[model samples]
Target: MTVTELLDRAHALGSDPRNTNFAGGNASAKGVERDPVTGGDVELMWVKGSGGDLGTLTAEGLAVLRLDRLRAMADTYPGVEREDEMVAAFDFCLHGKGGAAPSIDTAMHGLVDAVHVDHLHPDSGIAIATAQDGPELTARIFGDRVLWVSWRRPGFQLGLDIAALKEANPQAIGCVLGGHGITAWGETSQECQANSLEIIRTAARYIEEHGRPEPFGPVIHEPLDEVARRERAAALFPLVRGLCSTDVRQVGHYTDSPEVLDFLSRAEHPRLAALGTSCPDHFLRTKVAPLVVDLPPEASLEEVTERLRVLHAAYREEYAAYYARHAVESSPAMRGADPAIVLVPGVGMFSFGKDKQTARVAGEFYVNAINVMRGAEAVSVYAPIPESEKFRIEYWELEEAKLRRLPRPKPLAGRVALVTGGGSGIGAATARRLAAEGACVVVADRDLGSAEKVAAELGARAHRPSDVAVAAAVDVTSEEQVVAAVRQAVLAFGGLDLVVNNAGLSLSRALLETTVDDWNLQHDVMARGSFLVSREAARVLLAQDLGGDIVYISSKNAVFAGPNNVAYGAAKADQAHQVRLLAAELGAHGIRVNGVNPDGVVRGSGIFASGWGANRAAVYGVEEEKLGEFYAQRTLLKREVLPEHIAAAVFALTGGDLSLTTGLHIPVDAGVAAAFLR
Candidate 1:
């Protein structure tokens, strides 16, 4: 088409409601298409793909590609990658259809060969056309420069029309159909873009001046008490469905705000006919403008019917006209014949949809739009895309296609864990296992050097020393400390999804021999320390809204209080109780708390001191070897439990994919505690 013809068509199309399909039409190119003016092969074209708002077309939405290769690749790769891949393969996919996968509209673009194509649904265009002034307005805008075609269903027929137009006017920039978006092309990509923008801007301006919106008077609704409102919200599904005559199963009711009340209460509810969404795609969620009403509490079913009749009639009339103007003879009947609408009582509006999910999504969007409109009112005008324009983009096939793309990931593509006693033994073992399972670990211990060494061995997946017993050391213990540590962990490794509270201490003493100082020291390091660390861990888990596992290193002493271990046994028993308490308190917050009680853990564990070896030997009236053998023989497993065994228990508790068992105290004592009668 000639440049002037294209420009005229763009202008006409910009004002046509049917021209814009759901989700808006997108026009893109790859390789070089000859420019009408410059006759140069520099490749460029504007694509309507990125902008989320169908009503407004911005430069950012336009995806530019090499023209020659884009068309050819599309013909070649029918079912290849979608958007990004198509763009990436553009350079190599030249010539005939090779191994490339092209966009669905590749054939259409190749057929039109237009430098610039614009698509949108203009609501005012549809609203005005219910009568005859619509065509008259078209004539006034284009004069002789534009070629107008009768409305046709998009796809083959539309493509044919463009082909004919191109044949008729070799220098034509673009074309416009009665009920569709406009198309404009020029020798340069910029010119085509500018032409499209100018046409739409001009049409918007005309609508603002000629099609003035009616004023709505302030509506007054009965004030509702907070208790009543909350009760109403609790039964929101039934209430909202009753209001809008649609499902509300998935819909959530927000507390009624002043804006919602005011919007719902307007006396002269402005007709949405002129501001319908641009296309049918939007109808998937937003059926149509919500029906605004003010019904009395005593209103009868008949009264409600009468109000609905008025609103439905208006909507049906507008919809019929739109269909008649745009639908092809072969097109199927529109489903859900009635457009969705909102119903407002004395205050607040409810959105309607075919299903609950749709209704809820539409309601949320409506609320957001209301907020935006209210904010805009404070600054300037609260202008939204015409309803028809919104409809067109909502229904656009290309726009819908774009939404199917998945998101990408980051470099640290793994889980993260925090180990409380990661400085050595069971804590260190657990940290190492977590790292092996593709997790970055934060090793915290009272011994800073030990923590650093463990962290170094684990490479980049470890944390420094953190004392679980000290209030200030294990930040998870103190609110401030926990907040800081959690924040640091999140900042460093992105997030903390696991915590192993294995930091603890034990002292062996007879009941009478256990002094107050000894009891306090053991309690502080074991029971209090676990409490502090677990508290911090709970805080982090709650803050992140993550359900995490916490494994406390308790002991078999928790169940069997042995002689010469009064202080240690008591502390361990208290630790088990703490776990249960934490589990109960944090269950609602998705935090799982549990404990591991193990006995006879040899192999360099602090539980077995050099002095204990000799002391136990003396008690048994046997040598060290004999005492060790006797201790081992007492267990059902008939084996000495090692530090690694305890580590394994720690691993089982914190690991994901395990059963969600909280407040549990699993014995890792080889059944020895059961053998010893209390």
Candidate 2:
């Protein structure tokens, strides 16, 4: 098949999570390419590169290597002890710069002799791979079609062993790398994909037919109902997230799928989880093991939290011991003692990472582990690779080098932020800035569609990893909505680190024109709403003990008594006080509350377009279009204020530079002397 066709095939196979997980597999096709210098057809192979996920892989994600050169290296092989050196050797053999760096599995693809190859970590396939009697199971399931090879950590030598077996058994289409995963090869891309599927399906069918029932043992505790489950997660998430962030701040992901809940409820789960995941990909993301709470479903929240604190401390101590036991002097310094995966019997799992996507993927890897355990135990004991072997992979200098290759994180990296009124005006601008600065963002607004658009734009444009931007529909004036929106942040991103209270509206009216309803409505949305949002956010801020930011979007109207703005001005005045009030109360927790007072934001403003601009324009006897210029003329600088300017002020208050500064207001009003704080 052509190289283009091979990529299509790769996309088809990788699209299904059942076939393989995020970045858990590799695929390659051997073809003839015209050499740049000689202008002669040369045999070359294109394989998925290091750290590229097959599902989203592009031509650029493939490594191109000349077959002759790659094959020549085996003759000078330094053997298994120096097998890692072979990875460096592959660069000299590249057909070009190659699209991306060759992955560790490059040798396996190049040396296997087949025209096409697929190395996958399918859950069902790994179930057979990790089974205690994996060889016998492989023989029983696919007979001669699939061969079984004993586990060897992946590198140049494992490729040689697989190639040697393929040479000896010409009838074998593939081999299962015991305690690893599966591999298959064919003369063409289509044949290779089919053979891979054949093995996965046949093994899955074998387990389905012969596997024992209730393989994980009967449920030891029933799962909590959905409502209670979420409540518990909400209550405990900040606490758990805070513990994890002591070393490095992290975002979080919560999963309560039926299978996960069922697995957690089973009696055998803790024992199997403690043994840890078998796949290197799984173990690396989930860590050596998870922290499984010993408490049952019936425990009170207070009781459970108290016990969890002890368990967390114990987990760290045990993790430190594990590191010390396995690490040599040259090993990469301990990454962290925090457990990526956390399991509560009644609840499900909470996975954490430096960003939202990492936490989510880590949880997915653990789920794959659970599936592998289920399939393995159905037939025999679930046996993972030795801890020493896992340690080798975890602390390998190659892996450390990969980490060092990553681009440096932006200033707000690892922080989670929620922006109210993010649909338009200052809120949207602030959301974009924070995301660009590397924060995982949540755009909340009364207009769900508007929030989603801003969220989508920010999510796409921001490339720094570990982020997952989302949108939530919230009317900040409603306490229920406010609480729910804050909870959504905690659940989506582990915890909240920054809050921008930017949801607002204004109406200009004389005392006679302003009704009681106008006064209360404005007050409800700004004054009371700010209080509600701050109170709810403080719970998480205090729970995390991570210190946070709460930036208020007040107005110059709060300080300058403008004509026909009595209701709107008074409400903003109330919001202004909340910044100082909350700062005084939350300072001990490291949360800095601040405000940005802008004179007038005309362009791209939801409030202005919704008639506040025309109302104020009439009050000043100026055309609506000239109102912005009119305000600018009145200011000392004669320049109009903008959303971005206000947003920058918000960032300056909390973006690390102002860590020691709080209970302060920054004026973003193009020099409005009358509104200056005195």
Which residue ranges in model 2 land beyond 4 Å of their true spot? 461-467
The ten-residue window of minimal lDDT in model 2 covers 460-469
The 10 consecutive residues of candidate 1 with the worst lDDT sum are 463-472
TM-score of 1: 0.40
Candidate 1: list runs displaced more than 4 Å. 1-25, 33-108, 120-134, 141-154, 165-182, 215-281, 284-678
Q: Root-mean-square deviation of each candidate, in angstroms?
A: 14.4, 1.7
Highest lDDT against the true fold, candidate = 2
| Residue-level lDDT for 112 in candidate 1 | 68
Alpha-carbon TM-score of each model against the true structure: 0.40, 0.97
Question: lDDT of each prediction vs. the true structure?
Answer: 0.52, 0.90
lDDT of each residue in 392-506, candidate 1, tens digit only: 4444445445444523322112345777767777777777676655456677766667777777776642212221111113523344554455444543332445777676665
- Kindly give the number of clashing pairs for every candidate: 62, 2
